[model samples]
Target: MTDILDSTAAGTTRGAVSSLFPATIGRFEAPEDRALIDGLSRWVEQHFREQLGQRPSCHVYVETLPAEIVALIDRLRDSPVIRELIVRQVPAGSGFEPMKHTDELYISHYNKDRGGDQGLFDRHYDGNLRFLSSSMVVRALIYLQSDASYKVVFGDSRVEKAFTTYDFGLLDFHRELHWVEGNYTPGGPQRILLKCNYLVTAPGAGARGRFALAANTAVFYVVKAAMEYSKSPRTPAQKAVGHLCNLFRRLNIVHPLVPLAAIAASAIGVAVLAYVVVTP
Candidate 1:
């Protein structure tokens, strides 16, 4: 593993122009553990089978992860490469403190043919509060299955190459605009990826930052629900409204207005719902 990190295979980018073009930190192949990879693949398949009725896509949080998965996460967290990348982002003299919370760790499985989740394919940042905070939060994705449809694009870069199994990469969570194309055949392959977020916080985030984070989180859930609702079969009126919301989302790819547009669309939805309910 040390040799791998020191090799020319590792790469990092800095000073991105905007949120659309995020600074990539590193890309490296994780230590080969065929048994562990196979085990996790089976585990994820079974979990979705039992819990999600073999849905096209789903994610499982780290809290419910098996012991082996947890152990693997610990290993990744302690890796020298990941540690160095994280330390570089820390504010000077602010101190480095590792967070143990698992809220931002999860494993996602996506099958294009099974109607993948919009959230997974959407062109959006990683987290709800990502744009609101100055705290450096990095997103790491480790691939379990390789697929060409899973793409990451930066400024002027045409769909970065697909990641192979055991290939893991780290990028700025707040700045990267990742999305997938709508190219799904009837029986395409499933892609399973483990995702983790590493946060390096300044000592005093202050009350405003906390409030902004909470508010953004709430809005995110509401917008998520709206997106899910739009996907289902709906009446003509509902379909029209859904289209409008989708438009807002597409336009949100431009930074600074991403959250604002989402907020406006969500607020419109709430107001309409309120009027409908009270107009009896």
Candidate 2:
């Protein structure tokens, strides 16, 4: 997936610096291989089976759908929107989660029991570590839960400070806490949801499982920011783009789902960065 770099796709519309968004937000690019999804789904299956061993119910995402969706995500990773939206939007580094992170994080469900925490639970997700590591640019996490009995609870990092969910007390990793929740799957299994696209999982989106939490219930998205949130001035074209973006969003037309939203957001992100580069 990381193979397709700075290279632009076929249908992406081009605009000069002052006229685009910094990055893609809603979906991955197109022309991706469906088999890739299949492979990933299988990888998720095996990953859980072998690693978690207990097989605590999860969902699997194939390639064709999300792979394409994440591609646009990767594109956004390199855009100028990252600078404008994140850097100018917030503190220089206030918005970062972990404050700093390494590369990828790996978890073994089998350790849940062996790790002294029972090794398996229906509620919550395995993405605790990943989410914590999101202090860097932006971060997209995919949750492939067991599609059985589980729920992803999201709350403010402050609120979560008072209570605990996944029993991280037994965890030996870093101690920085994230704000989230968990629950058991009472839907009698067979319950699954795939959030193919849409990034920026900030607060207010919801603190519950509107998302599918299963075996392959992975949260996938990209991040190109490492600053705090802020308020900034918008140029005429910038405001126009923002206005159009709002229109599309009201229509429930974000890309990967709505092609244009993805395009507009990405172009706008790039433009944001380009504007910053030449202005001062």
Candidate 3:
């Protein structure tokens, strides 16, 4: 493992990826099967364009991934280093996410020229919001195609490391503030990344973890119910409310405060009505 240290403005040393990234897992090695890599790349292109009618600019969650892709994920997840990290993420061993395997599997495409979802390329950390509340997340990034100039920045001092095709990076998404360092302009090259997240089930000991789990669960079911409500027959006003709920879900802003806001509004309305009645 190569550990290069850089001196930042504060005169403190910012270490290389190895310093910040908890585990390097393995040295840089090309995958043995080039054909499998090519096949996976082709499948990703086709699935997004032909099957889903989505442009390469959009991020996609792969709900029904191909068997080969599934096998690939299995192999990566089962890597010795990854297994150890999983144990480290949740030391108890018994607690696991609702999904036994992967919490989520998704792919991202970034074009230098495209405008949509470009904010992802900005300097920021993955799972920053989720991690703030004691939820530790690990994301494995497998690059199908990459630009060596583009880098993943780490640490408060901001050390950068470039990536290449078939390069695999394991990150502590919850702990580090990492981001892409380069511009993707229209009519320029594109970057395709396949990311799989192994979500740590909220640790059983902390109230924070438990609350995060409960809040996530509640938001999930509320969003699910909103979808069902949208589909079912309803009065125009009810339909409008359902659509509003669905919008909130899509934005991921539905929190305890939302329901509390509604309650407060209703209580105020009731109080006004009672006052008017008494005055009359």
Candidate 2: global Cα-lDDT?
0.28
Worst lDDT run of 10 residues, candidate 3, spans 1-10
The true-structure Cα RMSD of candidate 3 reads: 10.2
Measured against the true structure, the TM-scores of the candidates, in listed sequence, are 0.63, 0.27, 0.53
> What are the lDDT scores of the predictions, listed in order?
0.51, 0.28, 0.47
lDDT (10s digit) by residue, model 1, range 239-270: 65566555555655565476576778889999
- Report the lDDT of model 3 for residue 108: 42
Q: For residues 148-251, what per-residue lDDT tens digits would candidate 3 score against the true structure?
A: 75667665444556776666666765455555666554433345666655444432435654554465545434543443344332467656755464333333
Top-scoring candidate (TM-score) = 1
Candidate 1 regions with alpha-carbon error over 4 angstroms: 1-21, 25-35, 50-55, 66-68, 94-122, 127-133, 156-159, 185-189, 202-245, 255-280
* Predicted structure 3, TM vs. truth: 0.53
Error of 1 at 31 (Å): 3.9
Judge candidate 3 against the unseen true structure and give its global Cα lDDT, from 0 to 1. 0.47
Q: Report how far off residue 249 is in candidate 2 (Å).
A: 38
